[model samples]
Target: MSNDNCTSNVSQSIIGVLDVIAPQIAKANGLLFWGVILVGVVVGIGTYAPRYRRHPLIGILFVAATTHFLPIISSVAASVTSTELLIHTILINDGLNSRVYCTQYAHIFLIFVWAGLVMMVAVNASVIVVGDARERRNIGPLKAVTGAVVWTTYLTISTLVDLYREKVATIQFIEQRTVANVTVLGQLFLIMYTKLIFKYYAFYKAKHSFAHGRSPSLVDGYMDQLQQLGDNSDTPTILKQGEYTEYDARLHPPALIVMGEDNAQVDNQPYGNRLKWIPGQGDKVLTLDRVWKLDDMDMLQSPSAQPKYLVFSFTLFKLLRCRFAKYTISSASFTKTQKFFRYTLIKGSGAAGERAFRIVVDELSFLHDYYNSSKPIYYSHHGFVIFNIILSLYTIGYCIYLMVIYIVLMAMGYHHSQIYCSDECLGEIFEADFAGKYSDYVQRPPSPVPCDTHADLIDGSKCTSYTILTWHIATTVFEVQQNQQQHDKCPHNVAATHLSRYCAYLVACYPELLTDNNDEWCKRLYEDAKKEAARVLSTPRGATATYPLIVDLLSTQSTHSVLKDGASLGKQLVDSGMGWEPLARFWSEMILYVAPSENLEAQAEAVARGGELITLIWAMLSHAGIDRK
Candidate 1:
């Protein structure tokens, strides 16, 4: 009894002591987070600038970006949502520090640090917040900007308070420590700054910055590798008469294993073919103006003229070398490699043969979030891969939360205030057709190919999904019939085919987004349509489902099956000889009709997967205050 009582007493005392010091413990926020950030920084440096040019680390960065989210949440909870965790403990006081008081060192040091941090926050935040033309998979601009504002504001406030403390040292710590809470933004800033700093140390400093004096052997050996690549490519000393152009648009870099060079050739959009310079302030934001580039000959003629694309040596051996032995690299010197790499990547032209290599590297870096460095997941470790996938999902959820906050804030802003924008900007963004209602399209049908060919689209009262599927089938039938007549793949042909297929895809794949409050019904409707489509469209044993047979059956049959209705429409379109341009216009209208959705759950899922076309259109419609009745 005595021994048990003693143990119990001691345990109670320890608990009592820990409880008393809880406030002080909470104040160790900066110290504790800094330790984690430092470790992350070190790990990140090794991950990106590995001793050799073996593989890419950009994918891993995206995967790892999700890591600090939980910690951020926990930190916020601990500090009562104050990100700075301004010490409320009465025992501790910042004003009492003798060394920090009104000294020359404090004032000068504060000025330098404050100026540097402010400049960096402005520049870095802009780069992060403004959408990059080259990077499609980054955290969207809204989230980036919001995060920047939140973090910078907190940090700025803290810095100002500290500066004031340095100058006017009398009992100000009481006022500073009395600050209640800074909110979730402070925690978010820590994660963002940690990521940004790590990126700076690993990618920018390792590849571009020349502050770190590079080794002699590293420089010499890297040049030799370049020489070997040049030799293997077989270059002429002088340009041929026809080969020379007034201004070459691109610069090709050396296609290294780390840049997905081993598998670049297999893709239609080759991994090594896309490159953009590190966007300076001069680089204009790539507008959403051209969603899908219309079929232009410039797209075709450009790739054919470049022979250096052949120089990329993609092999299974090289891929495996990058995958399994990324850390193990050739001992090469790179003293002047940073300058050469910069000029070769950022300044040179495609005729210079540096473009391909630059593309592979730049794409991997800029589009780190969207692409995996390796074939599947970049890292060989399955544990981290799975963990990252979970974190990514969490990050997506958080982004969606931010989006909701954005919408709420927007609504609040516009409740009593007028939205001010130029008429040109409004015209560009909020087109009437993008609301995509069937009623709206029917009211303004394109001429010459009268609404008779696709009368099903005239009824806005029908289930949106049913109309989409039926019309898409009809459009496909007509497209197949007209395939043998066209010489060139025109924009109309491309647009009609793409939109028709994509809308049908939404019907088959994303039915939940088509209906209001009847999710179960939407899903069941899809299954029924799918079954009907299979029954009606199925071909005979070892035979093709020809357009004529499909049209005849569809036009003749009178059933609830949407495919039959579609075939009937296809027959009308065929008889009318509907031009590709008009057919394309119909599809454009149909796509818009289907894009207006209210299913927030499906939308959230779609947004998490980098957003589908329908999702984008739906968001636009929501912004425009258009809704299905």
Candidate 2:
């Protein structure tokens, strides 16, 4: 009895202290929860033969999510506690109207905050709570089990204190939050359901499709009409037929862009101003038909020509894609593009004609679950989707509740304090790389370049993080320089912009996928770039992290850094007068070029976290038997 009394006193003391700072805690929780949503939804799955959750951020964020998010339940519930305190301190002499608004109108925002916790879990559970056995082994389930217990305990404590009715004013709201979390789990289970249903059929289909000459024929009908536009003598003039016009990609490939004489047709389209069709590097091969090297930048300024458009790496190992138009597609869509490229192979060289293309999911968890069948991967819960579907339906009610309340609150003009802490309002606080790191998010304007940067300064000739950083900076500058009116005409601006940032994020945050080099090289170079900024901008070394300050301090002397080369590239791109077309194609190819990795272990790890586009491209290329080895 004495021990129980002692425990009760201790608990009350903690609550007394919590009551003091709980309001501020609620505000912070609201902000962080939204940030997690912004990063997760905006950057869904995307990767390779690179690595699994190698970057510290993946593990760091996962542990942080489990530990930090548990208390959010109590903090959210504490909103009611806050209101009671408000009533006693400020509304003591006020009437029923004031007390009602304090209890009802003010605390309605708590619903949104509760939803935020559920969302945080939804975003993380796929990565943290549930993963392949290998990932589970590494991450361990103890953290998750502990977190769930803490979350429930917090809720239970609140209910116990306020008798379930006044525990933040209602019990159903808590129930709603729980249902929202479970619904997310159910939806995730549904995904796993489909994965379990089909095996590696896509891989086999892709290989057989290529071997049998059933290439990417989807665009054949659409492209034939476009090819006819180039039938006249005008077509020959526009096509750059050099001495060494063509070489089999199996032996040699070009990395330059070519434009037409009459730039009107190509210019109007998304890929018109972009592509690197390496100037005839003396690459020699007999013409299969009307083979023309598209490497001249001069074509953009030139006159009209037809669109016999097909952009692909004409080689065996680099079998990435061949697309028709400007649509960002699904996994199925990416596969279709690769299938189409086989036609180009058949036309380009008979020697390479018999080979098939290959692509895989190329991440660790995916491989373990599907490709890496060395161990028995139990499909123990594969049949759980039925139960999950029912739970998923319950989520609809919570959504309606949030929406209705949002409308009511917005109309009431009750938006203030925590209500104003929206993703947009708190958006700039997130780094541009974080925004770009997850390709799903709409691209925020990238970090302002302090000054012009240089490519020569970074080791971009090889697939290094420095290359990504330099190009990312250049891409950002070029994107910022675009004319607002042209945003729609070049539908690919968003693609290029997002890809550039995504690559930057990969290099800066996730480096193992891009290079076999040790991470120290990337960090050393990154620190060097910062030091260069400090030197050129004349800022203290300690303050280098301050982006705006560094930009303000930028000077002509900063010409030796990545910022200088990037600026040079951006200026060249701007002067080239092509819209985002070239950049779109450039990134399209750049991403694929880096997709082939010798590091299979790293790739498995990448899949375990969240996949990358490069990984998918690598996997697809794998189907074609295009490998680094």
Candidate-wise lDDT, in order: 0.39, 0.40
Candidate 2 residue spans exceeding 4 A from truth: 1-53, 57-62, 72-125, 128-157, 160-390, 405-597, 603-629
User: What RMSD does model 2 have?
Assistant: 20.2
Model 1 over residues 365-458: C-alpha lDDT tens digits? 3223222122122122344356446644654564576567548645745222111111111121111111111111112122231111221222
TM-score, every prediction: 0.30, 0.34
lDDT of 2 by residue, 1-629 (tens): 24344334334433443455455545645644544443343223111111223458655644554455445555655553454421211122222111110122133334434434344334223321122122222221233433443454445344335533554433232345545534543443333333322223222232222211112222222123223432343333222223341234322222212212111222123322221223442132112123334432333443332111222322221122222112222333223233444444333554444322221322223344333221112232233344344444544554566568668746855433221111111121110110111112333343342332222122357445666666666676566556433455355887877777666656555567775467667656655665675466454532542333333333245754576665566556667887778878988777777777756555655554456667666665654446666
Number of the top candidate by TM-score? 2
For lDDT, the strongest prediction is 2
